[model samples]
Target: MMRRIGLLIFLGLLATLLIFPAVRAEEKKTDGQMPSLTGNIEGGFRLVDVDGSRNKFREHYNLDTGPRLLNLSLNGNYRSSRILDDFRLQANGVGGDPYQNYSLLVNKDRLYTFEASFKKSDYFYNTITYPVSRPDGNQTSFEEAHAFGTSRENTDFKLTIKPENLFKLTLGYSRMEKEGTTFLTALTTAVPPDVTLITTPVDEIDDFYFASAEFSLSIFDFYFEQDYRKSDNKLNFLSDPTANAAVELHESQTVKESLQTLRQPISRAKVHTLLFDKLDLSTNLVYSNSDFDVDINRPKDQFQAVRPPTTGEGSLNKKIWIWDMEASYSLLNSLTVHGIGQISELKQNGNITFTGSSRDTTEDGTVINKIFSHTVGAELEYVPLKDLSLNGGIKRQFRKLDFTRISQFNPPPPIENPVILQSGDTIYTLGFFWKPLTSLDFMGRVLIGEFNNPYTNISSTDTENIKFRVRYRPLRTLAFSATHAERNTENTTTFFKSNFKSDGISIGYQPVAKLDLNVGYTLQEGKSFSFFSSADAACFAFNPDAVNLCGGVNGAFVAEYQARSNILSADALYAITKKIKVGLDVRNIESSGTISFHFSDLGVFLGYLWPYNLETKLKYQWITYDEVVLNANDYVASVVTLSLGLNF
Candidate 1:
């Protein structure tokens, strides 16, 4: 019924447009007049090969063989416009372990304008492998072992309407889906009895609706917007996985089955204004109230003849709420600042349910859990010199987390968990743009991690980031540019968490405007922000002897860290004739040793007006791991992907 209602509303809007009087031609000033009807569509295809093999800290450092996968993709976009009229449509479809983006867009204008579209994106895992050795001497097997390929999906819809003057309204809907979370697993013994390692999968759904309206007032840039949004969610159970379950592979594992569903609502209002032509300021106030339940399942069982007698039952529902507000200001020719504050509350009022031969029982527990967060930041980029510029900013945040829970059994649990976090951050930047002859500029972000967060265990990390760049335009078509960067992350978790003190340098060259090349290399050793205690040890090792050695490796898995790695990417395009063209693209990475990932893509084009386009990509790679998983090289795997696309 809801779907039908949505369709009906969409149809009704379309009908209203048809019944309205014809839209007269728009009369806008222009240096010259030309018949509209102008647009171009470009479509291309890609193929990728991925190794699904589980990667080990050893292989990550040694460069071993792992899993191999194949993927294909096609994308395109087009737009047309006249004196005062325009329209656009764009779409792209793809499948791969990498995050995929696909969207559709349409724009039109009568007296004003209206636009609507839908987009979906998916982020997949990095790789996977198998036949890894357990911390124990025996080998372990994961019929479907995946180092990374869990996925996060984002689906959203939007609508925009502008009626010449007076007001504009926008309504949108978005859903965030997180599925199949990964966990490092390991076993203690070769023979499995009692229970095999099982780390539950984590999944969740967040559905929301947003609507906002803006009214134009006064000659100055003045506007106001009111927003309303609500969220509803559903949660389910994921498979129990094992391997790094006991190690420091991750910060903290989810206590629940790793999946959840919730329903939340939000509403907000903000007014923005510009006093002068060069200065702008805006303040926004937003409040969100959500009512939802978070539940964890407890399995019923009989432990060693002590039949706990607990069967077929679960706990009551728990809830959480969040509220936040933000504001910002920008000077067209000078500086900018932004700030926000938020509060969150969680209720623990839940009743437990139990079953018996003669009666069913319900129990209640203590309600608990609350958190508050605040942040403010600003940046000033001033061009005081004709060829030099300065940029800097400061940010601060404070957080407090409290939790509470009660049990009918003996010792009472804390009413709430206690955690406090705060930080004071700052950044400084410098740049130079000089027309030394014709075409040359230098830019850099030689910044630092000035945030000092004392509540928890943290370090004052430093940065040695520097970039040298230059652009030359000897002639219009004969343009070229080059750049190089030397960067360092000292015990920092800024651009990426788990990044250790490392140095990386990258160089890129571009010629003929259509061709580009880049290469980068990095080396590092870092600690994970999670389970890694000040003391280095495998937090999971059952014995004091192996704990430090085994659990410590998990901290080495950095979603953003490619240690001892090298990367190369390049793209080139050439017009063989007026109707035919060719292009080439390549991407390669060497995490360690000779074991690496590489992709070579080729493309061809022919025809005009209603043109024809086609492209193909070939990829290859082998991976390996170390003490963390398989015995250095206990596992191996590979695959290849091919794709095709067309444009009109």
Candidate 2:
């Protein structure tokens, strides 16, 4: 078995050290006669304890709330003059609980290199609620009572070879596996609206293989890469009314199963050359193709009660291509010019078929899309004074898109009108950097742009963006900085218009050599207005003739909203002695708008260093998260962690 072979190899590697005599104290320094092998090994262990709901805390930090091993890590490297110039190994877990990560690497000066790694992570979706609208226009809610989450494992291996100065090759492989609990909601066609929350099990696996080559010469460079990926995803859901009775199942118990597979191949090539010292040129091309197949089986039909093991099958094929070229030239010692042109094309074809005891149907479609863009820019940098430096840049860009779709049936698309979605924008930017004195510095930038959708005259927009920063260091121990940024978009379209602005200031001071302090605050604000159009009315309203409009030609204003956010933070660190230090940090953030939330964290830590490369640290943190509109989701918790490390 592979496991046995791996274990034997690991043990053999560990045994080699016994025959190699211990490094003598006098041989710490490298002498010219022999190759010196030197490396450091450090191991750390941490313990975490939480006082409140473990799931709540775990959702945020991905750590166990109760007693758990935070980390048991080891890393080391050995170097020799032989073929194996360097060999390194790192491990972070005991492979028992929560997660694990491990990696191994080997390198030879210019011949070859190899690496392998494995990692695992967990994800949780704690809150899932279902809301139903009543006849009176009120909404009723039902929340999931069971825990839902998933865990993923990933593995990667790679090898590289470079036998000569002009050529190099690389090969790699990776795999990922995920297992989890998922939730789904369903509706019954009963007179009195009925809802069912279905708990499901999910299993997925993905694998990828890739290879690349590089060629370099005095005047030219070329690189090529290609990769293929495959994935299998499956889900199964079965119902038990007795266990989770948010509702009473009138019909047969629910059962569902679904599976999907995807295959993708991607490739890219790049070539660049230095025509001259002042001008450099590069070109790149990329292509990708993807195929997907899916199958689903359910006990009962979604639209009707009849069930003959309703089944559905679908498949999709997608292909894309991209090409780009760029060039840059140094017109002067302090000025430079650059330009880039790019083109992209995408094509997709898909079909789906459904069969049941009473009904059968099929739908198919194909779409083709393309985009072209060109950009040119130049930058200037000059230092007119010894303490002052000015820098600015201007760029112009043009872009266009074309799209077409053919389908057997009409369905609501992402863009109602493809022509209306095709757009182009022109942007300009300029900025300056000035440092008049050692204690003072300033930087500012301005951007202006215009967007036009030629198919529809009403869908154009004008944009303005500005940002500035200033820093003043009035004293040797204290420094202050402030920043302001704003972006305003004025849309002539019927969709929406918005403005966003942010201002912030920060200060850092070290009154004494051993103590340091930092504090900062930021404010962000935004305003937007949504105006409905005739097309929107035709899509959203049942009776467009019975409504008053914005200007009689277009629909009315749907909403006008303003949002604001404030954030404040402070941190302090003090060194009690050369080997001991203490630090504290506090942060508060609150946002109010169409969506509102508030979050805060306060933490304190203490660290100590001892002889023989030993260190210890203790930290405690308090965190709070709240949704202003939904107080039931509010959570506050405290966590404490202690870690100890030793180096050999």
Candidate 3:
């Protein structure tokens, strides 16, 4: 109702500016200081316990059981005030939280400044099951009856005028909302086409308006901005022909869909300069235009056995352009030079119309799309000594695409070509940094790329990337670090290949005088190779005849995938006196080859300082998930939190 009365009058004007600076803390004194209030206010209570799949514990920690405002802050400052000078208010996870946030800021110094923010989030998903091989060679297991959940909200407001330098102005507004439930799939004219799952309801909304301007003299600095956006989407589908009764006989439907979108006046410009005193420059521009509309309704459908009702309509137009430029030079006193450029363009047009009740399901369609892109780069840097540094760079990129499709269905349609694509890439880079001693340090980077698409065969003609880092400190509390990364890609006309690798190590320690420590480890690997089709490898061998396994060159083959991950982390802190403190955190993860998993996390915390500026905290957490090949999507969770605070 009126958005909960405008969110309770914006939380009662932020609780009257957070209690009017603590009730005028001893009044009197405007320019002689007296308006100062620091921040802190916290409250919390949370407990959660789950032992196995509450849909994988809400897909991993969507905590519940709570009374919380876990954190809040208020800050104020009024020195020589006519109205206000500084203010801030903050909040987090209010109550009954799946996620929540609130923020406010006000300032009146060089005229005005104001800001507001709000956020909320929640989402969940579940649906997994495998094994299905039948065509008389029986094997059964299924559960792809989809599931999705959602809740999203965001709001923002901003106002700024004259602050931090010559000529400035700003205005803004934003809103977003999403609500949901999902699952949709339909087809049931029987005879090898009986897949039916429908349960969909979703609503979405978005709105935004923005404005900006800034200017500065003496050599240059300028900016401009304007924006507008709107979107609305909805969907509802209801079908339950006895809900997939052992897979078949499903054709009772009711569907409705609508979509609307508009984007206009989205423009931006920017410029920056420093000319002569070692030269530096920047430039940017952006443009946008968009339009969209869609509608679909299927009053009731069961077709052929007569139940008919269908309709559809669609429209779209889009445009986008972007530009960028950058420059830098200091060619001496340790040399430096850099340059960059970018450009982008896109255009699209669309149309679709359908009305069915036979006539072979009336249809009409048209669509066109185009794209262009460009990039250029240059870089050079060298620092003869004094901790050493060297770098080199080169870049070139180009892209072009065109697509078109037109139809008016009749017994003639299989392939009607109108597609074009052009691609190019050339990238080379090298980087380095070294500190030859005094506790050592080193860094490295290398990249190589070359690509040319002769109209794609899954693109990627050659690519490689490598990185390395190292750091060490003998003692003063000991420290060490290491990292390595690699990437590779190749696709000599569909002999596709891919690779990725990573390694990391870290350690930090403070050993005494109040203890502190940290440890880390990470490893990741990935591999891929592709070329399928034997009716997609017989539907990944779940084969229900897979449409009688299509023809061609021994039905094509070669398909491989691999993934690996290992991570371990640890942290600790201790102070136990002068107001006490303690903390610990641990995490572990292991995953191997094509979807295998094990994960664990443990956390502990305790803090106290009660004596006037009161503060207290206690936390505990444990989480685990093991799904070595879907053990019914394993899960285990436990969490507890307690907090209290006051510091002003």
Candidate 4:
């Protein structure tokens, strides 16, 4: 509550300064002529995959796009009747994207104001990894990478107007698209590894719209904005994973397919106002919706028999909605308070059209799901002395979820076939913040929750956090600081679970405007083998059996990661020109436990800061994983990225 009130006063004073015409705009005339326009462009790439013999970076959720890009502006005049007008172009125009740009901003001023921009990034080359075992019945030894390529394009435009400077309105639109493909043969499962898994191709796209209003005057000021966005992602999930659909291999095998669709929609709005000298208030609202669609064609008792297949198509669709609202009020002179609250609803309403060759398998798949939640909180801030202040807050959070599954295949075939699952939990929290010295900062928050009903462990855990940092400059060209942060999550999936924790500190120094250097270390701790999956645990229920995998010193899958780790990295930037700059960044990660993994990243890029200016950039990224093991599967690759943009 206090935080909101404080910020309210801050905005009140800011609006007073703006509408009073007392503030000076930063503009300078150059030799009585228009200023010349200038800017640059950059792009780069990188590949990350599991470390091993078959090291390709291909898998679900492609991230291997070698090239990333940026679009922007520098030295822009927000109040010009005649805005920027410019041109420049570059590259082979690969993927229909020129490393540079060509543009013209002209026309007259009107009640309606408009702005537009475009961005395109060069190709992406990457891969991901999965575990593998040799025919020799060996437990470990092979690794592979799935090579993928990428392409992307985006654009946006907006228009606004104020017939009266005291009342303004605006509207805008945007679009984005991305696509990628694999570069290998379909030997996806060949021993010694076949390249077949790389045969799938996928692409995604999105469109958006926005509208808002803002007004200002000497005695009063008001602000408001509303936006609605919708996006749909598509993919052809595998209907079957078996090598031969006509022949069954395992008696009780798990069916694998990627038949799912995700759709998202979001609407948001905000309103704020300032009065006389001491009062201010604001209210904000947001609504979000997610639509889920799943389709699966399978033979009943899909795992049991090769003959007499119970095959058909089934789908489950779900929708979720969320609402959030926040408001605050403040008195300008001294004391202040604020509060915020939110509620969420996940409701599913859909149908599953079913099709099959036989009547026994012909059934419409329909189901419903719902989740409800609420969160409320408030805070207070008091200044006891000119340079001293105190802050505190209390919050309550609650969540409830219910899932009901209805089907005609129930063995008993009852009158009303429905499966219901109910879950919920409540939490209490406390927080504090103190800044006793100009160079010192402190903050802390603690939360505890009890659950009679909970859907996931992450949703009902008790947590704690504490952090501190200090910055001091002993000389004009030299400065340094240290910081430590840690977090703990309890009441995990089970009582056997141990909290996760990490602590770290670092020192940094900068001797010039173009150079920066810093180094730091962190230690991480986690739970052990008892945290393994129930099925994997049952494998070691016996002492001798357990020793083979979890043994006395180390357990199994749950204990595979190290408990303590350290990281060392340094980032730096150098200005090539007032409008252009270059950067270099590197990091090294090391672990203390036997299962710990070590890795590193090296990045280099150039940045351009010209407004509505086409900028092109090149980037190179390299990564090395599991540095401790002398395993040949340990591999490296080079990625190159090219990008073009205008105020992106």
Candidate 5:
């Protein structure tokens, strides 16, 4: 029903646009003058052909063949009218495409203005691989295969009154919806748990309304806004009985879940001021409160022999507050200083209850959680010369978390003790920009930081990053640019480390007035080390002493992987004649590591401009993708598009 409504609205707008030009033309003929309506409309058709796996092609690029409204733009002005002054309309990708957008704007010459827009997008994901042998001679692979896809839509409308320089009032409303199907894996409740694959369908919607006011004065500006939001979500999981039918003592089950949330009101305020023409200051603040309710239902099945059908209910109340301030001042003729500070806090409280055929429990004990954080930073910029500028800054951040949980038994056991954790980080940064020559420029920046988090092994204790770039344009028709970046991080407690480096360069040439050419290349390398435990080793180890040495029978071991990638691209365009042009583009990407792949794309286009405000274009594209280990996932595709446009 919603999709039908959206289509109706779009068709109505399109009809109005098509008739506007005719009406304006009639008026122009009567007045013996040109009309004020001006713009262009373009429409096209697309064709697609695939030689390999169609699922892989869809997963990589979700484009389909169809008739499409490529683009449209229309603008009209009424100079002698008293109620309507000007209006504009625009649309793109309007027919049977993966993505579409439309917008309209109208103004009444200082009294009021209104705007509306709509957008839709589609997503797809599908990848299947065969089983492989593990290092310990155990087979490891996914037990199920499926394709997942979804679509999302967004709509918005806004209006403003007295939209001038001094003060303006605005009201707006927006909605977002997502619906699709996916896959999930669950474990049965038996002694030796069995894995089961389930198909899941999801639906979600969110809506928001807001009002805002803005005021501007001689040396200061003020702004304030208030908003409200509501959300609804539903999910269904259906078990595949045949997923584990061959395995012994396996059963299938299904589940249903729903959630509803509301945020009554959210408030925001901001202020900006300039003092003495040398000092600038700004501050902003926001606060919001939300409530959520959730329900889950599980049916009785073969796996639930010891238990009956179960139902659960949960509720949560959350609140958050944030504020930030910034200021900058000129200390000398060649120096400036800036400072920034921010603080935020979040709190949540919730409870849960469950009921079944054999048991009924209402654990009303509330679960509470809290988080707080703050940051401060300062920087100074100095320009000692007309061609050189330097800046440096330091920042520090601190955070703390506290939470408590209660047991889910009848009468609710005693509330557990509250747990607290704290973490912090400090960073220093320096940057410089220099333009010593008329045709040459250079820029660079560096950062160093230290972090402390004793509660988690994945946290890094120290980190460093550096980046540099340079550009040279020795002549009017030729130019060159290069960039390099590096990052390193390590955890001292767990002996975990990672590093990344990248470099790129590009050159552009236009030796002739009618031709243009460009080429570029980039290389990237990265590596990381971490620890993991293998279940096969844990089940095979028998000696008690050996088990103790293997991380308490988990057989934990260090794992490492390295990856490198190279990318190359080239393009050219030439004006073959006075009314015709041709262009070509090519790109290739290759990577080698734990998982290797290669991708190539080639495109060509031809454009022609005819007499009497008419234009036509033709384009073709070819793409190929290959994986070194998963040959079944490889695919090749070809696409062609033709378009025509008319201007008035």
Candidate 6:
């Protein structure tokens, strides 16, 4: 509530300032030219219609293009040297399944500025029909119920002050509200049949406050910032039709309610400076704290005593602190060196209670997760000729995690035990740019990285990446470009390795002054091998009777797959007349793998401009999707849109 009042007051001040005229319309300009507002206001209305399967179309595409609606679009700008230096506002919205946005900005000289904006969106969750098989090798189709939908709104306001050359300040605030219906699953397997399937209605709100200031002088600059946020959520669970029969068995208490809240605060300080014109340094420190609380209410009549809500009435508190310093030095005319050191510490403590029929029990504990890291690197550049340059760099990073977990659930073992985890990586990179001819250019780079983790002895990885690009413009109206990239990761943990490679090319041609054409194609392929770990809990459940099948420390190779994909896209636009233009875009994507699928879409539009600043546009698009293994989910959609606009 306070945030809303603050925002309102801020806007009120801007409104008051806007009431005064910047200057008289008849006033003469100092430069011997009349001063007037130079901006265009455009108003438009759009008509959209959807065809084909609603379920498939609605899910695959945004609702604005899938439904019938009358939309509005407005944009304008104003500037003056008197009361306000610059001002702008924009608003647009769709009527049906409306998504709306509004924003305004005003600036006076270079000292003060104000901004406000709001946005909202509506979403839908449609039901689906699929085949449901029975244990007796029988299959039947079932249509799921239509669940509830969701809506969200957000608002933001900001004020800036730059009164002097040495210091500047900015203050901003934002709020968000979300309300929707969501599916809820039972927490325990012991719930009654009717309570297994439920729906949760949700209403949540979040607020944020931010403030930052910066001061600079000569070669030194400093910044200080703070941020605070709060959130509250209320949720209620109710039995759905699937659980209707079970609801009758327990009629007294059929609803559960939960309330949750979170509060967080963060602060940061940073400083940067250059010394002797040869070395540049910067440092930053940050601290953040968060508090979370949740309360649940369950009817005693509906739920049994054994599952008494797991009632937790306590709050959790967590804190994090981070500090980092970075430095760069110009070692020579063609070389520079850079290094950074950073550390982060995190701590969390919480206590929770479980309500039982006899009494309530409480468990409390704390955890510390700390990380220290360092990085150093150097870069070199050599230009022997005007058209050729070579660049190379190498960086090494080391990190250590001193983590301690001593909670009620994970008590420390006896006999003085300690554990620490450490990991780091080294990276090397080299690249070059060469222009052999006036119309030809080439660029390429290579990167290699070696990494180790706490489990490095058992599992580690090395990665290599290479990319090259070339462009040629032999003609004034034509250009061609091509690129190739490859990456591979080799893991020693369990004979796991993966590789990806891609090649693409594009051509742009301007046959005439009013026409342009562009086409591009890409091909990608990937291969990987993965071993299934028997230690996974799911393995035990899958083969309980035959433990030897997949229940050992050294799991067997369970999966190996290769994936390949191709993408082709083209666009062409032409100006038939001074007031008319037409354009077409086409895209096709195909994939082959264990999970193979294909998608393609084509769109065309025609635009016309009439006298008196009037304009009209007509667009049509078609999209299709196909699945080799699951054809039931494939569908096609055709859309048409028409819009009219007027500019003043």
Best by the lDDT measure: 5
Tens digit per residue, CA lDDT, model 2, 40-134: 33333334555544555566765543333334333333343334455565555433335666666767667888887777777765543323333
Worst 10 residues of 5 by lDDT: 243-252
Q: Report model 6's TM-score to 2 decimal places.
A: 0.75
Please report how far candidate 1 places residue 64 from its true position, in Å: 25
Candidate 1 — which residues are off by over 4 angstroms?
A: 1-84, 94-104, 110-154, 176-184, 188-204, 218-259, 275-280, 299-367, 372-379, 401-438, 450-562, 593-648
Please write out the lDDT profile of model 1 over residues 216-244, one tens digit for every residue: 56743333344333333333222244444
lDDT for model 4 comes to 0.48
Q: TM-scores across all candidates?
A: 0.60, 0.73, 0.32, 0.61, 0.84, 0.75
Tens-place lDDT per residue, model 4, 1-648, is 123323333433343344223212222332223333344334333343433433322211224444443332232223432232222222222223324221212222445444454555545343233233333343331123334455555666666776636577878887776665433222232344333222334456677777777776565455555555555544422223432221111122333333445555555555556655444555555565556555554433322223233333443444444555554555444456767777777777566554442444445545666777777777666666655555566666666655544445323352334444444555555555556666555555555554544454333344655555556555665555655555555444343334556666665667677666666666666543333322256433432233344332321323233357677777777777877878888888777664456677788988676556556565676766653444432545445565655542
Q: What is the descending lDDT order?
A: 5, 3, 2, 6, 4, 1
| lDDT, candidate 3, 1-648, per-residue tens | 236325634763664655565436534543356677688888979898888776667756678887787778877777455566777778777775777777788777877887877778887765434333333343323323355667888888888898545677999988888886665443345554355556656788888999999888778999999898888877666665444332222234546555555555688999998988898999999999888887877555542436566678888788999998999899898998899999998898888777774554666778888888889989899899989999999989898888877866655462345888788788999998999998989999999989876344355478899999999999979899999999998764445678999999999999898988999999999998755443355534533333345324343444456889999999898998979899999999998876678899899999998999898989898999987876877878889899888988
Worst 10 residues of 3 by lDDT: 243-252
**How much lDDT does each candidate structure score?**
0.41, 0.67, 0.74, 0.48, 0.75, 0.67
Off by over 4 Å in 5: 1-35, 77-86, 107-112, 127-139, 143-147, 184-195, 241-254, 298-310, 355-365, 449-465, 487-498, 534-562
Better of 2 and 3 by lDDT: 3
In candidate 6 the C-alpha lDDT for residue 455 amounts to 26
Question: What is the TM-score (0 to 1) of candidate 3?
Answer: 0.32
